[model samples]
Target: MGDLNAKVGREYDGFQGTIGKFGIGVRNDNRRRLLELCGASGLSITNTYFNHKLEHKTTWVSPNGLVQNLIDYVIVNQKWKKSILDTRTFRGCRRVPSDHKLVISKIRIKIQANQEKRRTIKFDVDNLRNERVKQQYEVKVGGKFAALIGMENMDMDSEESWAILSSDTKDVATEVLGYKRINSKPWFSDEAKVLSEEQQRLRVQVDDKQDLEKKQQLKRRRNRKLRELSDRMKHDQNMFWKERATKVAVAMEIGESRAMFAAVRFLRNASQEKVWRGVHGMLDEDGNLVTDEMEKRNLFARYFERLLNVDTTRYWDKKKKKSIADLNEALEVQEEDISAKR
Candidate 1:
């Protein structure tokens, strides 16, 4: 068997005409582009199916409705430029055992080698007359007088006349007639051309300037927001410290919370010589501020140090200083007395 060599093209399913064609693949857009480039319009249809394996004989079938549909597509769309004359179907083309037939379409697409075109030329001037000349030029009275054509009779339609008419190109009557009067038109002035370019250039410059200004505004907004946040952080820190100090002072007055915080702050607020420490309670019969006597028995229990100024431990030492000094001096005197007595 010989290969037909025709490239596999656009495929369709559900119809029976193209099923047995070899090399048919569902994936290929080249066939679609080729059909489009062929000036194809309307619908050129086909239908096909094949077995997954080669053991089964190939089958092709073209039903009457399918053929009519293709024809209808061609007719409705007025494409193809050729007619589909007839279609043939082979019941399992020779040795095939498939139930469907092999279908072939006889199309009238072939054309004569020499296509036709209009080939006539004549001299007539009505298609080339002006609006005013329409009623007059229709008379065509020029036999021999010739009238020295353009002195005062002819229309003022050259570059010199057009330039003298107006500097603005907008004022010119080119569009109403047809194409530009390039041959008889005044040259564009270098100054006007330069001005036009500058106008566009200025537009670009303005856009860039606006963009730059927007960026600067954005940067300023970001910086302002950041500064506001920073200020808020500082204010929050101050508020935290202030509230903590106030809570400690209130606790000391009512014994509602620990006195350690108030003691520390009292030390901080005190003058260098004044310190506050320990728990401050009402004076006993002896007229001294008292505290829990055991845990507070350290030097801290002896004196009232300024809360804001006192580092807890240091203030505690100052509070108990007299007791500590007396103890040391008493021990020293005892030792000396013992030696003398000896």
Candidate 2:
């Protein structure tokens, strides 16, 4: 939640639920930019949630008392929009120095006690494209296969044989083509991280100091560090996308269909397309969709089992089969004659 001074208008056309109809004044370039940021960050302007009079909604007024606008905003994550109890502008009896009015919000959020399991493995599949890595993978797999061949000599059940083969193959792949450490925020470069840390350190110094001049100096240093970090992040993103575009162009030119399509999907709007993330419901014998996981699985199993174990012998007619055989024989004889004449 922040006073991002964006005049998001009453017209919430593209913004939809993100910004409400109660917004004061017309939206300008800054408001559009704010809306774009909110959309990207999954935020919704919370002040628009409640119906309030213009006096309560308005956050700023001109010194001349002619113009009024709600420039201050409290934006929260869209998922947590409902958690916001209320948001309103309040005025004090005493005169205030700033033109902007005091805006307040009441939000309630529950923190989960249990922590999520940490994900350790970040597979570097891209590295496998290298010839050296490919050769190493093959060698590792071959060694595992040789060991599995020895296991095959021992008397084992069919299930055990399959399990051994599958497990060993996966183990070899993992050992040869190991995972890299997963950087949660890969966009934040090392330089940006250092600057952020320094900025926080300077902020601490500003808070500890009693001298106004010294505190202001520390604040200036902190702000400068933040700006530098922001610039570095923007530069990193620009360079990353530029490099990706080059790779996509090269892939398309070389006719590497798999790489080309993957790059195209990543670069284009198709990347935002909704994908099927779970098991699809299958139709049972009754032709009704069975969405329950266990039922669907059983239905598919029975379907494939009956389909594969069909009586093919009873399906074909002997008379039709005889005709097909006769036609094939005649065609072969005609082809041989033609070859001889040539």
Candidate 3:
């Protein structure tokens, strides 16, 4: 995403399929080059598709607070555009300390971890600093290790002993201290969760109603929900950063570089893009190219089926086969995280 500072504006006209109709203001001259670039690259302007509050539509606001424009955008390949659930400028974001508002887009994609190998769980090591927690962990680990050592008659090699010790330690740590998933995104609070559900309900009402006034009322309620969510997210983010800053400051004062670095990394907000192992064209056993997407997808499915050796005898009749098109089609549906639920 970049601040293009070019307004493609309200007129889609010839570029209807390339851009959405929800853009703000009139198209500037720069839009010609923008459109040309997008057309050549098969990219679509993602921000224009979603309907949001005016506060969210405007990415740049004047210092005097009078002028606001949608000069920034997030673009994605035309084929992958459906993966984008929502795109909007968040005016609530103030952590960046910038003139331009934060542009956020939520996209749904899957990244699979290797299932053949058992990956060790990363336990919350910092929790061991607490005296009670440290004692609990020590007790658990000591008990597990004692049990393993009790088998005096068992003959074990050095590798086996090391593996057992490592596994037992990890298991004990997980059981006692629990695990923390690495995440940097701002988390919504309970208030935001409730408001999101209310907004979803309001959206359904707006879609189902035929009366203009009722629909308008639902729209108003949804708008109010959006505002509340924004405020709530802003508050949550502010609190998180404030606490984080305090921790980092303390760490620095105490000369704990590791803690300071960890805090800094957490606040850095790393960019993670979903990398697809795309199948351009696959060759069958006969050395012929399988050019169709559906065929390529089936080839992958068959290959994995053989690799995993899934028993097809029982469920073959009832199981429905899926194509790449089906997966792409599913991406068209609007998506939300668990926080949107009641």
Which predicted model would earn the best lDDT? 3
The candidate with the higher lDDT, 1 or 3, is 3
> TM per model?
0.18, 0.40, 0.41
Q: Give the candidate order by descending lDDT.
A: 3, 2, 1
Write the residue-wise lDDT of candidate 1 on 1-342 in tens digits: 111212233244331232223223333444444335323444333221222232222233244424211111111123542365533344445575433445555566667789688855332343346666443433333311233243436566677555543332222222222343222112223443454455455555555665777657655655565565545444443343444455666777887654666557553654343222322334544654434335245435444444445568876788699789999999999999999999
Pairs in steric clash, model 2: none
Better of 2 and 3 by lDDT: 3
Tens digit per residue, CA lDDT, model 3, 1-342:
898878989888888668998988777889899999998899999989988888989899898899898889999999889889999987778897788998889999876886897676678988989999999988888888898888656998878888899999988877888897754454556787798898898899899999999899889989998998877766665555457667888999999999999987865642342211231245776765564456767888988878899777657544444455566666654344333562
Clashes of each: 24, 0, 0
- Tens digit per residue, CA lDDT, model 2, 69-136: 88888888888888999899886722758888888898788887898899776567777889998899
User: CA shift at 338, candidate 1, in angstroms?
Assistant: 99
> Where's the lowest-lDDT run of ten residues in candidate 2?
270-279
- Per-model CA lDDT versus the true structure: 0.42, 0.78, 0.79
Model 2, TM vs. native: 0.40
